[model samples]
Target: MKKVSLFVKAMGLGLLASASAFAQYNPKASYEGPAKMNTWSVSIHGGPTQFFGDLREYDFYPVGNTNSDSYSERGTWFVGAAVGKQLSHLFGLQLGANLGNLAGMKRRQYFSYFRSNYQQVDLTGSVNLKSLLFGPNKMKHWKIDGYTGIGVLRFKSTAYQLGSGRVQRFTKHNAGDGTVTPAGYEADWVIPIGAAIHYEISPRFDIGLDFRINHVNTERLDATIGGDNSSVYDQVGSRGSFDNTLARKGSSSLDKYGYGSFMVTYKLGKNAIRVKKENGKYEYDTTKGTYHLRWTDPRNLIKPPVILTLEQIDSVAKANRPKDIDPRLLLDSDNDGVSDYFDRQPNTPAGSIVSGAGEAIDFDKYVSAALPGIACAEIFANVQFDTDKNIIKPQYYEMLNKVVELLNKTQCRLQLSGHADRRASDRYNIALSRRRVEAVRNYLVKAGLNDANRIVIDAFGSFKPIGDTSRNGLQKNRRVELRLVP
Candidate 1:
């Protein structure tokens, strides 16, 4: 009982340690993390088994003799199959079935031999060492797991008296019990604890070596317990009534057996196994059972060339082009050497030697016209503006049209001098005056003026005010004056 208590404590501590180690595993750091829910695997294994019981030799020699030939046989075989589910990276559960034969003999007190065929069903809790200790990594191709569980064992045994060559099949109620009713075979509770190490050859398959020990609850497994008139012998009759021959002193220790085997396991289910390629490397996806192909170099992917239409190309070219030159500076309507702004006569005959007016003139006729001292009083009109406004009112249109008519009738250039009130900053006033000049220029140009270049502008920006210091006077100051220059 003390030993049993210690073993249970050891197992409990081992489980706590396993849980601690499992808690340390970080799934995000693992190359391939835990399997998804319902992931399953099936395994088959077979190997030699050994039994330790009261009927077997305690040492290499027989119980009360030095003869080694009287020792119990040591060789037997067992085959088993199991189905398991990975509940997490660190833990899982397995259900297994095993079929095997057990045999033992005693020679000193009563020569006896018992051969039994047994079947067992077990359910175990399993822990994966690889996942718990190191987490999941691609380099870890080997996995070790430990498992422990309770199960049921069913057996049918036949005992033999070696010298007489007599066989007696033991039934639970009749063979060992001195009763007329039969109790069939024996079913015993067992505890199986073991470990296995596996090498993963592929995502779907693995091979492993397993070792396990099963602790049985009953001491009657070999059909012989020591002591004449023992409780077991009294309950069930001794074989052939040879009570003295068959009975020996019994001990309190129970029987145990174990096996060392090799197993091959295959993962089951559509999502039980998979491999994927990511960032130029292969990775196993245990959840989806699929593969993903990734390119290391982006250039490996095919791409179409870009093409542009003529209209689109033109639009792009225009967006990047420089602004056009001012037309006023370059105007030479008569193909004259002098620009239109300085030319008095813009329409000059081609190849004619003209004066600065760009007109073909007789030298003597130019002196006579100039000596008469042409009475040139400036013909002008002042177009008033609203305070701080550049828009030309409808009443000012007639005055601007008269200026336009005068410009068409004579070889004269018009000067538009613009002004603003002293209400804002000097810079703003300067800009306002410029806008007033441009407004008048645009109106005169639209009113049938043959050449807009004939009109020039000067902005005073309230410096040349022709009115008094009053509100009405300030409005009058914000005006453009058209002065004709001959």
Candidate 2:
């Protein structure tokens, strides 16, 4: 019981240590499905075996003197083969069969030597150490396991006289019954418990060492059950006139045998190789000849909105800004209070009462011109046009009315200057500009101006631009200006 307690404690400690190591290495790990093959293995083992039974001495020495021999003489050889299936990383099952010979000698009162040939079959459950402790990745080259199982053992034993080398066969039948019965050799239940360590030398091959102890339920494995002296002496007679006593001198404990073996195993199924992918998924790469787990987009995982710092915002704002700008041109290019867009007289003098066109007021010129009956001041607006267009817009009707009123009141001739944007060739622009002048002149003549000849037309291509040739500048250039001719 004490030994059993110690063994249990040791197994418990080993399990606890394995669990601790597993937790440390694979904190968030989970079991992946088995690879693309069935997990099965076949193994063969052979090694030394030792037996402990009633016919053996208690001391651990190995000498046979018909008086003081040891149990070490019971050591023999065993060979076996097994097939196993791995159910998971932590557990597996095995079914195996073993054949071996067991022998023992005792010389206390009468010398007796017993030899047995046995065949056993077992089914076992195993705990995989590498998988349980540090996962399959750590099990690449080495593995360890503990196993236990129950099986049936069949054996045949013979008792031999030492000096005469005479053998006596034990009968399995009870002749007291009237009916003749044949007892097949001894058959008993056995429990096999053991541990093994293995090294994988190749993808399909492994070498290992196994240590196992088989405990039998019956004490008659040596052919001596109870300590009945007359029953045994009658069977072999007196050896050299000495009484041959086959009585059991050892304790009434059941028999137990153990084996220490070297084993070789071959995996019988396809290898399950895992391939890793870049996006958290699994796929097989033919070029690399391996399977891998791939990473995937994290759409399933929660993400927070990004919050930018003030410095980052500032950097983005300034990235597209120009390094320098002409302040004078941006504000008032001609030193006029009005900006360039509204400044019709972009070169206005520093101090002058200017109209909204940014031109200096000329009351004397207006009064003088009016006194001569020429209403030149009435030409206050220019007729604008769409790009490359000659037709007059409806909104310009009122402005044209003012021009007609001034022309009717004045005796002076009016001059129309037409211009175009710099979009086409010079000849094309000059033609477009002349058509604009003709359009304005024809409109005025149709609006009841008696002397159509009083209006003179002139055209200028984009060579005479009033501003930079930007979109707004082009629109400004595509116009017809009205001015009184002196």
Best by TM-score: 1
Candidate 1 regions exceeding 4 Å error are 2-38, 58-75, 130-139, 168-171, 174-183, 227-250, 271-486
- Rate residue 89 of model 2 by lDDT: 52
**TM-score of the candidate numbered 1?**
0.48
* Global lDDT scores for all candidate models: 0.64, 0.63
Worst 10 residues of 1 by lDDT: 291-300
Residue 248 lDDT (model 1): 20
Model 1 lDDT tens row, 316-431: 99999899866545665554334577667776764233445555554333323442223223443467788888999897676566555556655667778888888888889889
Candidate 2 ranges beyond 4 A from true positions: 1-38, 58-75, 130-140, 168-184, 226-251, 271-486
Worst ten in a row by lDDT for model 2: 292-301
